[model samples]
Target chain A: MSIADNIETESDIGLSRTGKQREFAGSLAMPHDYFVLLKPRVMSLVVFTAFVGLIMAPGNIHPFIALVAISAIAVGAGAAGALNMWYDADIDAIMSRTSNRPIPAGIVAPVSALTFGIFMAFMSVMILGVLVNWLSASLLAFTIFFYVIVYSHWLKRSTPQNIVIGGAAGAFPPVIGWVAVTNSIGIESIILFAIIFVWTPPHFWSLALFRSDDYKKAGIPMMPIVAGNRSTQNQIFGYSIALAIVGVLPWVLGFGGITYAMVSVVFGMAFVYFAFGVLRMSPSDDEMKPAKKLFVFSIIYLFALFATLLGEALWTILL
Target chain B: MDNIVIKVTRVEDERIELNDKQKKARRARNIAIALLLGLLVVVFYFVTVLKFGPVVLERTL
Candidate 1:
């Protein structure tokens, strides 16, 4: 059965009560529910990328300052996630993938989540500005604003290009990290941003291919839902090519070393291969194995690419 | 205004209190969160002032 039908069935079983009823039915939600609102997995990726940026940027930062900067970025990312959850609760309730989210599941009141998110956002930005440099703090604030206001509220429901444009929010972490250290953005930091920005479309589109029905049901304008599978697949392939080139650009420009170059070349090829596999698959293939494979590999590709850069930076520092 | 206020208070008291225990739990959670946030602020303070010391202080001042 479709996810829509599943949601209907779940709702029929008393899960569709008003938010107030659900909120009052249970005692306070566990701490983990609050954590879920932060979207920890996504936050982890933000933290890792930001850390890499901090490490690779020219100059040394006191370890404590670095820790504070990374912490502020993480909290800011989490705050954005919370705000996204709060705003998207209505659609999130209907989507099977998001049905269990804190607000939608009624574990946390929407107001509480909103307050928490806004509070964290303000606190994190202030801390970063006061402790680290104002440059990094401003970037973090902009990242949060872009994700919560521009992407979540505006673009997500309106356009198939949502992820493409909204991807900038995620791209800023590395730039923030770089700026935290160098107190300015450089060519290398811009390259880091470009890598994630180009990589996001193909990575997200592959997931959308398999879960197009979720977007359709939720009235979200994901690429596969708005533009048919073939077009999305082609776009994914095109973006993957761009991603591969941009992913290796740091090494090519001599910002990164041979180790980064090797990892980028291998993973870049792997990413393109997966996208090609998705491209070649017919729409009638219900399993969507190729798309699923591409989605999973895209994550690994990013992690490996960034980890290579981090490793290279550490090597340079230690040796 | 006096009569209206009296009636509102009476109505508010008569309203069913569903899940009084749950309300308590929610209050507890909020308190916990407040404490955690306060701790985080303290940590941020220590990291900024104690760890970075005069360099950070000089910049801020």
Candidate 2:
């Protein structure tokens, strides 16, 4: 039977329905299904960081071109997210945290999600290449491939270091944005890339700290699943220290100003302090309150640093 | 005489009637696709204009 046979109303996506529906009636897929398929939250982060990268570059680009570049990157990121959801649908259905995702929730069928993902990925890359620089286009293409093929299909199931490596795919956006502006890659942009790359492990590990059961049940080899809580806690602390130092680099390297430096340093210290809390918390603590606190603050820390850079860039442009 | 039964393809077997919600969902998706296509055209036009600049208008016919 088609997945639609299984879909009860919107409110009740009944558990009675099979979790992973490989084949389904395409017409049953809703607009909201496709929207969530894009993983809007992740897309927003990609778009925001990319916009900052484009804005901070030492060159001028017409506003229209800039918009196209950022839109393409956003679409590309969305396409990758869709592919990830498609592949992970099986595991996602088992995990409470991911159970509501489009594929797992049966809002969208796996084949439909895959088709939409591939089509969007092709369009985003081709359009970006035709209208913008090929360098940026290639990076966009690579990011999608890396996220889908390397991370989702392979490392995610095979290794505990999945997020650590998969994190690189997310890190590419700022560099792609910078390249879109300058038509070249530079160290300054690499530092921007470093901020996201180093920030990902701890941020995800903190979430995994609390959601370890979910990952364990899903059979995904997340760090906390393979490594004991104490080890994962230690690693989170180490990455936090690294993120704090790297977070301040833009200011030290002269790309960021005093405002950027101040924001990064303050948030960076706070991030490390939160990680230390995670590190010191008793492993058996059922609440995982320290890990949860770190998880929430890590998001704020990244946003504060990037927001400061974005604000500085806008200020320079205006004044 | 016993008659042979035919098997349908998986997708055909999976065909579902579009309930009101499903129909509405499909309609919404169609509208979104149309809008995005229009946006794409606008983006391409603007990008071309920006890239070619005054040279396009200045070119000899």
* TM-score of only chain B in every candidate structure: 0.59, 0.64
TM-score of chain B of 2: 0.64
**lDDT for each residue of candidate 1 in A1-319, tens digit (9 for 90 to 100):** 4433333212232334555555554647766778888899999999999999999999988887898899899999999999999999999999999999989887788887888899989999998998889999999999999999999999999999999999999999999999999999999999999999999999899999999989899999999888899999999999999998998899889988998888999899999999999999997779999999999999999999999999999998999
Candidate 1's docking class is: incorrect
Best by TM-score: 2
Cand. 2 TM to true fold: 0.88
**Pairs with steric clashes in candidate 1:** none
Q: For each candidate, report its DockQ versus the true two-chain complex.
A: 0.19, 0.31
CAPRI grade of model 2: acceptable
lDDT of each residue in A221-304, candidate 2, tens digit only: 888779889999999999999999999999999989999988998898899899989999998889999999999998888888
Question: TM-scores across all candidates?
Answer: 0.86, 0.88
Taking the tens digit of each residue's C-alpha lDDT, what string does model 2 give over B1-61?
1233334323223324557866787788889899999998898887777888877678566
What's candidate 2's DockQ score?
0.31
